[model samples]
Target: MNRTNLCIRMLQLLKARGKMNTTQLADALEVNPRNIREFKKELVLAGYNVEEVKGRYGGYILNDQYDLPVTIFSDEEKDALVQSYKFMRTQKDFKPLTLYCDAMDKIIATSKISSNASLHYMSNSIELDKKISSMIDKTQQAMNHGICVVLSYQSLKDETPIEFEVEPYEIIHYHKSYYLIGFSLLRKDYRMYRFSSERMFKCDISTRHFIHDNHFHLSNYIGEHSLIPLDLKHVIVRVYHKENGLRLFKEKYWGNKLLPIHKEDDYTDFEFYTDDMSNLYQSLFSMMDQVKLLSPDDVRETYLNRVEKIINAYKG
Candidate 1:
């Protein structure tokens, strides 16, 4: 290892093992015992808290409070990190956007000397409106501080905005949109609100502080295949162009409960247990003639009706 890497490894060893004598550190780092003192000086000069112990069991110890910034990265790891940053950049209204960019800039600056690889990434994430972005920021701040917020929200069913107090718990991203999960003071229960800039007229952070409910867990409300708390259904579909359909499902619904129940030479019968039927319908519609809803008679009827409406519209 180079001198720079050796110094870093020594600090890491000290941090992990608590304390290490010169000989022990040298053995661990595969360096000479004499170089240990030099490495300690280098770390101290770089603002790391490396302390020396004088007793028989003593050696060098990194202060427990101070954490060393991880600067080491392989070429592949650096490329992957850069690509992640690029992808995040595509989400123009991502909360904590500035913090992520600043952190990535620091990492890139440190890794520039080791590798100079260029990478590109593309994403189709929706760009959030400015008002919605501001609301998300406010909600995040409230969640961090354990505070209440007054939200003027208007759901699709509500003709006018309904002002209510909420104990903000968590904000989650799903399907290129943001949702707030919190305790609604009006309903006196947990609720999930999909953010809409046009409908959400006000999101004012209140002065009242709140203690987070210890019994409340996100998993209790949201299932593995759900965007919000809802009952999941067993759905089966027959998809033509087996190769293409399989690839699409694997790419889009990799984590969901998807399995192949049957297959033919040209088509495949895929089963999915999902709570997000809207997303499912949208994805199936995108596949056009290559997909068919086979089971759950009501859902199949709904899909057929939607297809018929589209067909009729086209005929007009």
Candidate 2:
């Protein structure tokens, strides 16, 4: 038989039997074992994840998720379906589209759709950073299968890399950065790890499944803290609304722990939370005449003392 016909037969047989070693496939197709291995390579290049098993039950099998029921769609029907998918692909929220593509990939693969056709119709709208995309893909797979992932995390300050064994809850993209929000086994708490600063090298799907709290929400967790945790401290600052400074603060820096603005004539009290006080102080100091510390006696006095020192140093 021709190579194309033999591959089609091999796929059909694997789908029926769930798996087949090279010897079995070669015998069934009346071909050399090397031919079977070559066919597996071709399947992989065509976007099918053909996984290899080792030891006594060694064989090549399609990924369990892709062992889909047979599908029959005419060329015209597929064209129409892809057109509709293209329209939905243009929508903003990507999860739904991602899900559709995953299922469609299986359906089309089972139906023997050409790779070029699949690529043309199902192109992604969003472009992810290639350096991080592989890690993101692995983490996502772990999330779907309820597996534990080990990541090598490098912080901005730390020279050495740290290992994190986490149960990934979600991958969030915020402000041109990606974050993996997961339950850290080491820290024994829910934490958000920066994906770009981390490398995911291994994933182990334990037979032990996790009991997920239905009430656990990513937004609620992030709402309680800033995007990056420095040294958290509650702060209250008074700002004179000179040239709409309050509006600018609201537009740019407004987030968690920002208490309602208390307006008194020309000044407004801006109560918020911050982890990095040095950065916050520098920002406030630059606005010297327009902003003032409202409370937290020590922080207020510190700002005042710094201003005094700057004034003294520049004495005429």
Candidate 3:
């Protein structure tokens, strides 16, 4: 779209294919010869040398020694990367990207920003776990190459490890966890595998490949920050004050599916749907006295019992 993006895409094309002619680059990038020249100029201006060859089946090539720095980051991309880093730091199973995390802050400062709001300094010293990182690499390779993956997943409830082959469609980051969404041959259906908690003991790219379902839409399968369908149960919470649960529901990061039922000057009734009652209960429990549960007697009872246990623990 923009000059920088076009140049970057061209660089990516050249990097992938080693070299390409004017026609090949034009056809691959879906741009004209003039546009390819313009993209090359932009890349050259950005400190990348684009060599042109003048022969049959010769076009342009990126030099092997030149490395591309991550220079162009929009506000949205910066926010996404920051959030991912924050999530990565929270996972004890893997070491945090401490240097990269610090570098992100420096990049944000150097980059132009329209807002004057204070940024959250989430500096932490943790390193990524090698075993888990290896799984991630294998999973990414499977997704990129359209190949099946063999994984040994260990669930907390299960003693023995479960090994299966799956066709990875997408990798999702929900809350503070990473999940691989794919069609599982073991389950004979589409499912999501959470990498942080479920724990992948072994992951290998298989020679077997699969045709990605073009009709599959990730947003339709999982909500913006939710991994599963929210159609199973409806949860209602009444907020007596605006600064309480109301404020949290209004924030974009809290998920946008919270429906306001009754809106008044001082009080508001909000409805949230989720299949996982345990998760809903945990979220509501964090709010403490700010909210009241209205429906689903079992959920309410569970919340109350948990609260009682907490209170008794403090008292004891």
Candidate 4:
């Protein structure tokens, strides 16, 4: 890490973990023991009250009463913050817009980068519905307070609306949709439910509270679920330059998994991996004339059948 980040991290360690000896701080920051003393000096210079205690058991601690100084940001970091503020400004349902704008202005003022120069990029993310926004706020509050919520959910597979209690663990945003990942009392297992007004009729936070499982890691849980799987299916495709296949690869249309296996004058064989075959097939179909599925007979047959059905529909 850079000197600025290192100093900030040292202060964070002291504030979060309380008193720590130089050796402990050095080990945590992966720096020399002498460097911890230097970091403490830098923090003190930056208007932080870092006090050292005397004795064998004593160590350095931050004065909890003192307020933190305005954090200085690098030019690149300032640009990123400016761009994020611009993106959030476009979100109609963002409730804390005023506070965020004020905070961004103050942060940018302290940096060398001009906020006006960084306004070149705008996000095309879908705006959240007002109902969904309200749902997210309530769910966040319930999760913060460790309370259970009664959700009236209408599953697509079933028309009847079912009421169930869920212990909200995390709210996930994927593919322009919000999902609540929680423990379902009805199923007695973890479940992921979409947060849409069409699907979720109601969500009421109950007075009942439950102890949050400290061992529940969101990444570990998502890995076990199919929403974000760890196992990826390998895919191979022969791409011709005729239909902008090479341009798609250049633009990283296949995400981070696109790789070249073999190259020829007229065509190239590329390999990639994905957990979502449906999305992959859609992408391939969009460029069907320029790409051919070479391996994985089952997947190839499925793709061919879907194409055939589409052709038959057009013929009819």
> Which predicted model would earn the best TM-score?
4
**Model 2, which residues run further than 4 Å from truth?**
1-128, 155-159, 185-189, 198-220, 228-236, 241-288, 298-316
Candidate ordering by TM-score (highest first): 4, 1, 3, 2
Better of 1 and 4 by TM-score: 4
Q: Give all candidate RMSDs, comma-separated.
A: 16.4, 13.9, 15.0, 14.5
Candidate 2 per-residue lDDT over residues 88-191, each given as its tens digit: 43333355656665565566557765322322112224566665777777777676566777877765776777776887766655545567777887776777
lDDT of the structure predicted as candidate 1: 0.72
* Per-residue lDDT of model 4, residues 115-164, tens digit only: 44421221234688888888877887787677898999988986789999
TM-score for all models, in order of appearance? 0.55, 0.40, 0.48, 0.57
What are the lDDT scores of the predictions, listed in order?
0.72, 0.65, 0.65, 0.72
Residue clash pairs of candidate 4: none
Q: Mind sharing the TM-score for model 4?
A: 0.57
The lowest-lDDT stretch of 10 consecutive residues in candidate 3 is: 113-122
lDDT of 3 by residue, 143-205 (tens): 767689998887677797899999887665555556687888787677778776357777899
39-114, model 1: which lDDT tens digit per residue?
8878877978677654346678886352225577777777688557645644433677666655665565445522
Model 2 scores a TM of 0.40
